[model samples]
Target: MSRHLLLGVALLAALHSAYAGGKVLMLLQSEKNIDRFSSFTDALTAAGFTIEIKGYKDSSLKLREYGTWLYDDLVLFAPKAEGFGGSIDQQTILDFVDSGHNVLLGVNSDVSEAMRNLAAEFGVDLDDRGTKVYDHFHYAVKEDGKQDHTLIAATDLVDSPVMVGGPYKQPILFRGLAASVPSNSELATVVLSAPGTAYSHDPKKSMIEPPALMVGAAASLVTAVQARNNARMVVAGSVEMFSNDIFNSQVTVNGASTATANKDFCVTLTRWAFQDRGVLVASNLRHHLLGSEEQPWGYRVNDDVEFLVDVMEHEGGVAKPYKADDIQLEFIMLNPYVRVPLQHDGQGTFSLRFKVPDVYGVFKYFIDYSHRGYSYIKLTHQVPVRPFKHDEYERFLVCAYPYYASAASVMAAFFALGFFFLYHK
Candidate 1:
């Protein structure tokens, strides 16, 4: 009976693992070859994600009907989406993603206006319908020994481990459009960028008359944004990179040819987007008196307090501390009264010691960390601040002895003068 029970428990655990794997919802073009995404699907499956693909025609505006919450990620790869059917408009998808779910958005030259509008709403400025990004000088050479100027070899990857993770074996292939993210957007960060020789224009048009709309490093080939709620969105200018041919293609620059980084790039990108990696989870936050780990409902002014947080970064498996650098802490009233750098001891715990300000009021310990390509981390702990106790006040001070003596002498003289005046009267 014990053996049977153990077997039953093991079976249940396997079933749970299958159900708990990341689920994906992909909206693709019905006209395109479905086999084109065979490798993409395989990669996702290898990463433990179950994918569900539906054509725009079949997709419904009623996203809840398809269990949006049930899915962990959404991939919008419909470049030629003329219009969405049912109630699944741009806002519907955005609202779904805004609920702390992730999305991987891909666009092309034939990108529909609806898709462009959606990109704009996310602060991603995509090029016009017919325009494309090209590097006149750095274009990849084709297998035919001819330069394909339109197939740009983008080498400017952002220096972020949470995004790219490791050294890419080769540059990613960008054969599509370009975009720009709002400069003021704290959530948006460029993941891939075109080289200084790149420009955006309509290939069919006369190039001599029109200036390049986007030039140099200003052209954003790919970008990612982490919303205030820690939801991530990865926007790519090209969908071809996910195709099997491109994923396996060799990149030729000048006279040299080597295997491309397309496959690794896409897989890593998906992992980051799905929050399997580059996700920071702060838990088990504890703050108390420096010496006594005792936590009180409130704290006294001028007390030395200590703050500690267990900050772990999530990657496919167990979460561990992202002990990269100094995290920040702020003691805030109406305004920030104290700001200090948190130190970690090579463990998951981050801590800092600071003296409570003499001025007492309601305050909060605020920790806001905005790491690019990672989820936003904001923690606020409220603890009221009370003034020092009556006994806490100084009874005597060497510096103030002169002032106390002068006050005593003035009182003595006042009494003498009062007696003299009474007697004379």
Candidate 2:
């Protein structure tokens, strides 16, 4: 019986692992001959994830029948598909993203309206003046002095260790043709851009006039969006950037040739988009008055209070301290009563000290810390301030001592007169 019970428990554990729901579903296009899905899947699986690739042309499978949440992540490699099958439309994809799932959408040189509208939802304009990107100044010069505009290289990556990787000893270079424009919509931020030497134009046609958009002023070749709910999306103009051909290609820019695989960039970017990196969390947030073990229900005026926050990076199956420079705090009561900058004292502790305001009533000590590339930390401690009690008021004043003396003298005179009249009568 004991052996049977152990066996049953082991089987249950296996079933739980199988249905863990953290798997990634890659939706690939049938028309495209790209087989790089296995490479990306392998990387994610090696990092302890279960990935499943599904081609849209498979008539036996239905996305709507798979239920609301078949996977935790979705990768759209089906840019050329005019539309999706099995209840997977624009609204379905948007709802999937809005439900806190990660998405990696790739746009080819020939993009469709569905992909364009989806990119627009994230504030990225794939149609920049209705032309492909071609750089004259940063193009690769052929042996005969002709510029090659198709296989351009970019080495300027965002210097964020969390988004890219820790202390990137080597830079990532990309060789492909992709163009993007900046997003003017709210809550969208650009991540990477081309150098000033690059510009966008039609490859098939000749340039009659100067290009309308330049490199620096243009949006970004590769952009990432972090939604309000912490759901992430990485949109790239080139799907071949993740292929083994480009991943193993060498890039030479401005006489400096470097042989580096695009795999590093792809892996780091995918990890970031899939919520494996750049995740900040606040764990233990505490506040109290000075010299007290118990958090006070109320505070007196000018009371010294100390606030501490334990910030951490929740990634890689470990919760570790997050040491960063851009975190801030605010102590607010009606408006911002005190704006204090928390200083990390070389430990996991972020703390600050300030005297309580002189105003009396219910007030809150607030810490509103929001930084780019990190999760926001908001904490509030509701503390009531009490006015002075009856005995707490000033007992003896110099100006009021004469009034006290006069009242005492009158009382004494009345007592003496009453005693004398009674004895004489």
Q: Each candidate: what lDDT?
A: 0.81, 0.68
Q: What does candidate 2 score on TM?
A: 0.80
Give one digit per residue, the lDDT tens place, for model 2 in 1-425. 69999999997577445323357877777635436555656777776667777775555433335466776788887777778766577787788788877888876767777787888887677754245555555544333455566555655677676776644433344333344555464445555567666666666778887665545536377877888787888888777677665655455556656555457777777777777766676656787888875776777778888888887675644456778666677666688777767787655688888887877777776766655555556677677877767887788888899999999999999999999999986
Model 1, C-alpha of 202: deviation from truth (Å): 1.2
Show the colliding residue pairs in model 1.
61-87, 61-88
Where does model 2 exceed 4 Å of error?
Answer: 1-21, 31-34, 57-68, 128-130, 140-147, 166-186, 217-219, 255-257, 394-425
Best by TM-score: 1
Q: Which ten residues in a row have the lowest lDDT in candidate 1?
A: 12-21
Q: Point out the worst 10-residue segment of candidate 2 by lDDT.
A: 168-177
List pairs with backbone clashes in candidate 2: 182-219
Give TM-scores for every candidate, taking all chains together and pairing residue i with residue i. Answer: 0.87, 0.80
